[model samples]
Target: MEERQKIKVGISIGDLNGIGCEVVLKTFEDSRMLDFCTPIIFASNKTISYQKSELGLEINYNGIQEASKALEGKINVVNVWREIPAINFGEATKEGGDYAIKSLKAAVTALKNGEVDVLVTAPINKNNIQAEDFKFPGHTDYLAQELEGESLMFMVTDELKVGLLTDHIAVKDVAQAITPELIKSKVATIEKSLKIDFGISKPKIALLGINPHSGDNGIIGQEDDAILKPVIKEISESGTLVYGPYSADSFFGSDGFKKFDAILAAYHDQGLIPFKTLSFGKGVNYTAGLNKVRTSPDHGTAYEIAGKGKADHSSFKEAVFTAIEIFRNREEFTELTANPLKKSRLKREFR
Candidate 1:
């Protein structure tokens, strides 16, 4: 088999004062990671040096101005911002968020220009990152608008995959957002992602109910029966293997989610709460249905743990690996889909 070319992975330092630097540095400490892909971190050398000193890490990164100049066998750092911001750890400052957006903006520009093959982002403070440049709720929403593609906030672990139907919306507004059209679109995105990004040819999906006990047969709410049931039925009739508006409370407790390839949650907390409870530091938040690759650690910027050198880099490392795997899977899928006649003829032969 021919060896594939190394992919260039872009890194965005989330909140400068947060544990983003810690995890990013810890993850790249093992130089062997360079063999798989070239990592171009969109953070200043000053920031990285400060983090290394604070964490007492001896890891070294090659500083480069351009992502294209990133070298193999070494970690690369790009100075997104030249000015040194005050390093106030554990505090939610506007300066932290400003530099975080700067790093993200530069890395995103590189991603768009094909300077990077995939992007693995560290955690950011949503509140502080909220400004004129970044008015969106979070990275997924921002990336969706920037890339002109619909994004599904898909959380992935070894055992389970959960995709949110309505992301960053309030609990009170979730019921109103649970429409048939939204359900169908999100489920379709999940289906496509499973096939192309995950290499799952025929994905079995379970949709969690919006209300308690699946609306208790319309006693508590009507969305589960009226909207969810009809939509799942329609999607199933279209040859998709989707089932259930399963009650959220008992679904995971009964291990019901293990039966399907992925679960589509009605809203953010409905799916993410259970997912985080089950997986915690093991999950990767994958932005599915996008034309480009983007993944982040399931957890947030751990302000309490920032600068303590206690931050777990497991999820961040997993995010990088997952991004690479998904990118490879997408490439293979594109090649496989490029020849329709060949696929049709092969299907006839198998039949």
Candidate 2:
């Protein structure tokens, strides 16, 4: 049999105190992961060892300094930190937060240098990580600055994909951020992401309104009519399939969302509330429009249920599967785009 193609995937261990380690370890217990890609975990040897001992998992850990040292049947651990404090499950400490950031930075560096095909991050604590040096809201903003690309946070499930225009901002401040340029830029990023990362030829996007009943035609608010409508119109004219400023409240009820491949919300909660409501445990949070592919489980650190082997690895498992699929699709897209004959054959097969 032909050797299975190997794609290098970098993983950043999120808060050591949380279920990040538990889920990550549990997810990799399956040997089948080697069939898709080589997983490179950016974390300390001690941290992983502690988790393995605590969880009573028999997973093998291979310490390596470089990506090329990865071997099949062993989980490669790139020791980014030398000494990590003893972890207290369900507790968030500054040390754990700093360690999480360190892991993330190492993985990102590997990604930018072409050492990895994709990046799958574990969850980190937003509040615990807040400090003088770590000022960014979350991974989205931090990755955006590092990659110098406009990033969009999109939650993915088998049934729906939802993108947020403004994330981690206060609800009161959402209106101020809803300029036409911002909407246009975010939508364009989402469109490009769908086409390039997801291999969608023609993406259908649904845009959600800022107010109830789509601003009730200017009675509730004029931001939809003034900002969103013009932006959507301009994008549509540019040959991108986009519609809406659909009422946020009614969009989920009407099967109106099913018509489009993805939905763009005006702000954070507008998109996430319904998305999390429907896809809390099973959804995967994907950071789109980045130079490298990054995905995480949709749920948070879940400190309340950190240890005890009760954490579900389904989302993390889905995240790994999603990363591999995206990586393969991107490779296929790149190859086909370079060869017209292959592209034509693919189109014919789909048709």
Candidate 3:
């Protein structure tokens, strides 16, 4: 395999009171991770030092004032703020939330400015992170607004990928939101992401029904039969093939999800509940269809395990690696698609 350029990974430290810092530090403690990318952590050195002492860790890292000064083969900590805020483990406080936002905003700004190749964020307390400047449901919505593009909350792993049609909305409103236009738009974004980000040439997508048993052929509910099924048929005939309004209940139970490249669910709990159950420790939440690449762990802050030295870093580690791979895949796909003659010539030469 050809050696690729080292990508800069901008990381955000989530709630100080939770296990964000623990997982970030633990994920990069092995030192071998620096070979693939230069990690620039978006938090103050004082905060990292405090967390390191509390967690009894002795990891090597470098502190820098800017992302541009980050060194290769080093864990660079970009000091977002000089003063360290008060730490309260296993609790949510206004101070911790404020600090978390500062780190997040700084990293996002760097990402937008092209200072970093990808962003890997730790978990944040959604309730406490809410404020005047940040009024969105979560990172996916917030980043979508910031980047001025739609983002699909794609849950990814080695086995299967699941995306939500209606995210962070009430169950009753979910049915109304599943219009034919919305389904087509979301499916298009998912298909593009599957090709560019996952390197799938022709992706197969399956949509789960909004109602129980896919509305039992419109006997249980009319939305599935009226809105979803028709949209799937129209999209399939248009060149990009897609399947389903499959019963969400039996799809995963019978391993039907494995047949498709990606699965699109009607609502949040409908998709995430099953995804988490299957790929909890290894799944990555990829914000697809954006100009920038961002990934987060499948789990939350885990406030109960904060500062206990027991937080697992598997998902966080996977998030970083997934971001790197997606960035590379996007570059590769763009290069191939930029010129048709070159692709044809290369294929003919190989043959």
lDDT of 3 by residue, 113-232 (tens): 999999999998888988999887788888998785678999999798999998988898998888898899999999999988887889999999999899998899999889988888
- Best of the two (2, 3) by TM-score: 3
**Deviation (Å) of 167 in candidate 3:** 1.0
Q: Candidates sorted by lDDT, descending order? A: 3, 1, 2
- For model 2, state the Cα shift of residue 269 in Å: 0.9
Better of 1 and 2 by lDDT: 1
Per residue, candidate 2 scores C-alpha lDDT tens digits across 1-351 of 686557788899999889999999998887776666688999978888889999888898899887667776678999887886768899999888988998998999998888877888999999888878789889888888888577899999868999999999999999899898898888899998888777779999999999888888899988889888998999899999999979888898877888988999988888999998888878989988876788999988999999888899889878887887777767778888797466421111110
- The Cα error of candidate 2 at residue 26, in Å, is 0.6
TM-scores, each model vs. reference:
0.95, 0.94, 0.95
- Listed per model in order, the count of residue pairs whose N, CA or C atoms clash below 3 Å is 0, 0, 0
Q: How close is candidate 1 to the true structure, as a TM-score?
A: 0.95
Error of model 3, residue 344, in angstroms: 16
Report model 3's TM-score to 2 decimal places: 0.95
Whose TM-score is higher: candidate 1's or candidate 2's? 1
Candidate 3 Cα outliers beyond 4 Å, as residue runs: 1-3, 339-351
Per-residue lDDT, model 2, residue 91, is: 95
